[model samples]
Target: MPERPEDDDQQLGSLRPTRYATLAAWAAVGLVGGWFLHPVSELVNATAPVVSWAQPLALFLVAAILGVTAHATWRSVHVRRERLEPHRAVNRLVLARACALAGALVGAGYLGYALSWLGSRSELADERVVRSAVAALGGLATVVTALLLERACRVRNGPDQA
Candidate 1:
């Protein structure tokens, strides 16, 4: 069963934190969907799109940006270096939650795609698997950074709270 948030969370207008189970569910969906892509394309005689280094690099860049955001948020809110606006914090929190879920799906999807290429005779199989695996790792990093951002948004007990 999903956890029920305490009354105080609602009273403070805070959203319930994103759950790992939900991410897992999305990843499962992506995995199954990705596994079918190759076979379906083959049946239709369509070629698979090339997986490139640029894809993984972009994901890694996003992860880096999120990590910086998380660190900034942690300093502003948790460390009390500066006061953060309520709306901005909420926005960041929502972005973090959404990205975390998205990252999980993308990661699993790439992993499934890579697995499908294993033992295949095509010369492209090795390239696809290697590139897809790197992309999957980038996606995992995105998820980790996003989760860190979410955790950074938490408001610790301070002099104002009861």
Candidate 2:
């Protein structure tokens, strides 16, 4: 007569991998954001150059930390040396997915902004291009780290893997 909670849980158990279409959608949003922010970025850079350098460094550091953590978690699980708490693992997986999406958006936006600066002869344009490139690299690192983290969360053929 009534649906059981277990039935809901069963439906949710069929976990699927992240889709490329989702990533592409996020990237599209980022492209729009970058296009819209280009003028503002130019204005900000004219006043202060710190953000252009700092943002990329921050993103890169985040990526590195996530990557290391993912590696450790994967190794521990693969060897059966440690057990990951269910809640913690779930949280990490969610974080990884969010980062992956965000990274794609940020990377696309930076690239778009950089492209907008191409063909400009001003000294500021040169600086913007370099900074944008660095930021884009940081974004790429974030995406890679997130993807690795997601992969690490997958269970192999074991009963407790999920």
Candidate 3:
């Protein structure tokens, strides 16, 4: 027998748990990728002194963003085809937003440190501490932003939390 619309809606809600599972899996993959990217990027930085400019690094970051966007787009399409609202995939969106914010903070922090290192006359300990504090603040901001986004999405898509 063909499924009823309510049955479909039930199935659609089921997608939420599946989406959460996918988000968890993707988070694991991202963690592995982070490890891999670190050594690879460090090696590139250490060995390829010729191309360590803003342009190449910026392009690299752009490419990484594009790749992530593509992955998200594909997953969103899949969810839509299953009759689910993409925004209801809260877990995935939250995870992606958190990761994106974290990455942005780390990249900006490293850039700040590099600029300070290049401009400073001495490698002062206090300066290092200040730079680290700045990076910590960036991480805190990212966490706050992720929490806000998640809350917003939840309020828009679901009933109010008690």
Candidate 4:
């Protein structure tokens, strides 16, 4: 049997791009989570010696790796003659989507925590603010890279296919 146009349309629509609203919702959840966790973090800081630099650095590294991988994947898929494996492409899309959501949440949470520390007169307030800000930046980087990766996964249709 011949394939219907509607069937092809449905298949194309299944590859829809990620929505901003979904990201926003995740960020909102992060904001609320951060607000709640701020006090707990402060309490833990008071009780134990915590390294402030590690979190941001780790996030930054993850972001950099994701960005590089995304770029390579895009180049391989669009510019190079080699075709991407179906399983590999699906895996990349899944990873990108997961990272995008996670990055949004983490970034919002760190930003919220940093805002909470702003203008505080406590001895560790400056350090906390700075670290949180850096972490937030790292998170932002992850979000941006993840979004780019997601976009890179799009399979452009040729004139004949379209």
Please name the candidate that would achieve the greatest lDDT relative to the true structure: 1
Q: Rank the candidates by TM-score, best first.
A: 1, 4, 2, 3
TM-score per candidate, chains pooled: 0.88, 0.82, 0.34, 0.84
State the displacement of the C-alpha of residue 126, model 3, in Å, after optimal TM-score superposition.
2.1
Where in model 1 is the C-alpha error above 4 Å? 1-12, 157-162
| Model 1 RMSD, rounded to 1 decimal | 4.8
* lDDT leaderboard ranking: 1, 2, 4, 3
Cα misplacement distance, residue 105 of candidate 2 (Å): 1.0
Per-residue CA lDDT of model 1 for 105-140, tens digit only, reads 988888888988999999799999999999989889
Q: Please give the lDDT score at residue 118 for candidate 4.
A: 74
Better of 1 and 3 by lDDT: 1
Per-residue lDDT of model 3, residues 1-162, tens digit only: 865786566446532212344434544454454334433654688421111244334534544554555454444444333332555455546564655455454544443443334444443534543543444344434434443333333322333311
Error of 1 at 132 (Å): 0.4
> Tell me, what's the RMSD of every candidate?
4.8, 3.2, 10.6, 3.2
lDDT of 3 at 89: 53
- The alpha-carbon root-mean-square deviation between model 3 and the true structure, to one decimal in Å, is 10.6
2 or 3: which has the higher lDDT? 2
Candidate 1 global CA lDDT score: 0.86
Q: How much is the lDDT of residue 3 in candidate 2?
A: 66
How much is the lDDT of residue 58 in candidate 4? 88
- What TM-score does model 1 achieve against the real structure? 0.88
Residues forming the 10-long window of minimal summed lDDT in candidate 2: 42-51
What is the clash count of model 4?
0
